[model samples]
Structure formats: C-alpha cells, structure tokens
Target: MVGDYDSYFADRARRGAETSPTSATTEPAKTAPAKPRNAPKSGLTYKETRELETLEKTIAETERKIADIETLFSDPEFYRTRAAEAAPLQKELESLKTGLDDAYARWGELEDKKSGS
Candidate 1:
C-alpha cells in the first residue's frame, strides 16, 4: 500500500507539472563592489603636483647630504678637513625639515576641506 501510494503521488506530480528546460543559472545578488585598497586621493592639482615633486626632490637631495655629512663625521681625517661640511648639511636639513612641516600642514588643510570640516 505504501509503495502504491508513493508511486501514485510521484506519477501525479510529474503529470501535473509542465515540462520546461532550465536556463543558465546565475549567482546570488551582491551588496556592492569592493573598494580599492590604497591611500585616499589627495585631489591635488597640477601645480600642487609640481610643487610636491620639487619639494620631494629637495628633501631627497638634502637627506643624501645629511648622510654624507654623517659619514664624514664618522671619519677622523674627513671630520677635520670637512668640518665645514656638517654646518651646511645641518642648515639644509633644518630648511628641508621646515618644508616638510609646511607640506604636512597644507595636506591637512586640504583633507579638512575635503571632509567638509
């Protein structure tokens, strides 16, 4: 009786259903696209880019000078002969340090404006 009942229901379901072909399936809906993992855009203009490049080059050159000064300071003979070396490098480093501070302040101002703060 159970076998007859099961077969009867199965046959009835198959007969009642309309036979149709399945279409290609698709993935479930997603929330949103992934964001890029990078530093936020500064929205700097062309002039800003040129200024930054110039400042960065100056800073790099100053840093190299500082490194050379340090090397000279380490050597007794060079330290005596190049006593004048440290003064200029120190002055340039201080100037570059001020430039970096100004750049950071400008960047902060830009960021604040962008955030509507």
Candidate 2:
C-alpha cells in the first residue's frame, strides 16, 4: 500500500511539473496599460495665475536683494562703509522671503482645492 501511494504522488508531481513552465526564459505576462501622461483638464484660474506670477516676481526681487547684500558683505571696504546700509535691505529680504513662503503655501492649498483633493 505504501509503495502504491508513493507511485500515485510521483505521478501527480510529474503531471504538475509538465503543466507548469520550468524555464525562467519564458516571456513575461502582459501588463495593464499605463495611465495617460497628460495633466487633468483642470488648472489654476486666472486670478490664481496672476497671484502666482506676482509672488514669483516678488521672490525674484528678494533674491536679487539678498545677492546684493552678500556681495556687499564680502567686500571689506563696503563692509566698513555700507554694512549699515545693507541691514535694512537684509531685513526687507527676510520679510519678502516669509511672504513668498506664505504665498507658496496658499498656492498649494488652492491647487489642492482645485484638484478636488
């Protein structure tokens, strides 16, 4: 009886091995189609676009001021004569940066709302 059972299992195993592909060389199964790459039809409204543009311009101006301050601080003569002059510009730049950050956060919130997130 044990021998008969062993032969029965061996036959079942052989059948299973034959039905399944043994080699990894077989082509992979087909995948689902990819999602479209285009952005959704929805986008920023005209007012939001204008606000973003304004914020971007202000940020650019602030960046220019920071660059000028850095250059002035690097020059020994300017540091001695005009370090005080750069202080207010530096403070204004910091305030602009904070405003820029707030504007960006607001933009993100608006985008999420528009996207129905």
Give each model's whole-structure lDDT.
0.66, 0.74
Candidate 1 lDDT (Cα, 0 to 1): 0.66
The true-structure Cα RMSD of candidate 2 reads 10.7
Model 1 clashes, total count: 0
Worst 10 residues of 2 by lDDT: 19-28
Q: Per-residue lDDT of 1-117 in model 1, one digit per residue for the tens? A: 356888999977776564422322445577798887996565666776566567666656756765665666678897677777767767776776677667666666655645657
Model 2 Cα lDDT, one tens digit per residue, 1-117 = 256888989988988888677655577899999998987556678887787678667767766766776777678998677767777867876786787678678767766756768
Misplaced by over 4 Å in model 1 are: 1-42, 82-117
Candidate 1 lDDT at 111 equals 54
lDDT of 2 at 100: 64
**Which residue pairs show backbone clashes in model 2?**
none
Among all windows of 10 consecutive residues in model 1, the one with the lowest summed lDDT is: 18-27
